[model samples]
Target: MAKYGVHQLRGIIGDFSRVTHFPNANLTVVHNQSKRLNQSQDLSHIAVALLVSTLMQERFVWMTAKTNGTTYRSKIVRSMEEAFAYIDDYRKTFDTVEEP
Candidate 1:
């Protein structure tokens, strides 16, 4: 039920990539809309580095980054729906906890 604030990256690619964070959900999503096959290692490195620095409990990168062979701890997904499903599942983990 948490709303997400999106941070879009411009001029980096045709479709560009969007980073959205849902603080209340403890989720961070990177939606890579670019179709470009060749993404530089540096860019992937920087993206992963940023994700690693975040305190969010869950991180997801959708689209092209998976094909680029960049190693990251964030879950690589194929679509926004899948990402949302993952977040939903994650939230269920907390639902089992009883309130103090």
Candidate 2:
């Protein structure tokens, strides 16, 4: 599920960049990171695509994964702080050069 969330976030960033006529290399970096994550996890493309479609219409996303009888959950909420935090972390995660 983390893989799918990153995938959706990348797509949204890319589409926004194109629609606004503002090209951003950081967006591409993030997309590449997500692609790598997906490949590393060996996720199902079809399942991820369907999940991305479902997430497009929703303000909140919740994902869960279970291993060794333990379950983990991650939630993304549509709030100003959450959005900013995600962007900040993404920027740091990929170590992209910031634009002035």
Best by TM-score: 1
User: What is the lDDT of every predicted structure here?
Assistant: 0.33, 0.34
Model 2 stretches with alpha carbons more than 4 Å out: 2-22, 45-100
Deviating ranges (above 4 Å) for candidate 1: 1-74, 98-100
Clashing residue pairs, backbone N/CA/C < 3 A, model 1: none
How does each model score on TM-score? 0.27, 0.25
Candidate 1, 1-100: lDDT as tens digits = 0142112211121111244444423222232322232242223212222222232312433223454454342244445554455445544543444245
Clashes of each: 0, 0
Q: What are the RMSDs of all candidates, in order?
A: 15.8, 14.2
Error of 2 at 61 (Å): 20
How does candidate 1 score on lDDT? 0.33
